[model samples]
Target: MPSSRPRCSAGSSSWSTAAATPTSSARIAVSIERSRPEAVAALALDAYGLSARERQIAALLLAGLSTQDIAARLYLSPHTVRDHVKTVFAKTGVRSRPALTAALRPI
Candidate 1:
């Protein structure tokens, strides 16, 4: 019998559905469960003392996006994004992306 389970493909930053089967369904469920905590942690940006714009930029930065990419997503200029990044660094006392990510990651 043809499997009815969902087949997922790795998209840019998430899964894309192509077909369905029981095994794939289970995998998708597991993936979602695993990501739930990380998602909640990402929402806790306020704990870092970042402003609204800074929080948005920081979230995208933590997601591995470049300043240009974040600027495009937020429809702001690249310079503006860079300014926000610098502010975030100063506030968090981290001078680089990896450092910022490490500082913000849940213990």
Candidate 2:
């Protein structure tokens, strides 16, 4: 039987590096500054049963921010961000952010 896999070329890294840079879609998706504010609010209301603060944190997480970024943006500590994440996990009954991601995907 013949294998159908393609070989990786030595020049792939340059292509990968170019593609890895953030583009307009990624910029839009990750725009902590530009994502719809009401949508985040509504996601909190419908999905996770989070408090206002927790919802804010969840919005940042869903927007691909790290805990450190969330903390810095919200003027909270990383520990507090982590705690909010824990509460979000508890309320949503999800064990991890990947699960949260999956739950939020359809919306």
Candidate 3:
């Protein structure tokens, strides 16, 4: 059986370290140290300037799903997934998913 518990990476220099979990197949649940939630929010805002849905998509992308896989999981059409990816690229100023992930990384 697949483990439900998530693997966590210690956050970057700008944010405090805390445990995070992968909850539903849809999204991960991260428990940031109390002092750092605001900073995390700020970093997310700065990096992608994404709406909540876009941010969720970007997060899923970072978790490494192909467009088709993303579509299947998100219940979106593949074309819609591609469109969101395009918007994600434009908003984050990154041409590719790897770049987008790197950009989303902590400062």
- Tens digit of lDDT per residue, candidate 3, span 1-107? 33342223354535555555666696666565433443453456455577777876787887788989989998999999899889888987889988876766543
**Candidate 1 global TM-score:** 0.60
Write the candidate numbers in order of decreasing TM-score: 1, 3, 2
Q: Candidate 1: global Cα-lDDT?
A: 0.70
lDDT of 2 by residue, 1-107 (tens): 22222222234221111112345564422212222434434544455567889778777777789999999999998999999999987887889888876565434
lDDT by residue (tens digit), candidate 1, 7-92: 23244344333433346445432222123424444545666678989989888998999988999999999999999999998988
Q: Which runs of model 3 end up more than 4 angstroms from their true locations?
A: 1-12, 17-47
- Backbone clash total for model 3 is 0
User: Which candidate tops lDDT?
Assistant: 1
Colliding pairs, model 3: none
Count of backbone clashes for each model? Answer: 8, 0, 0
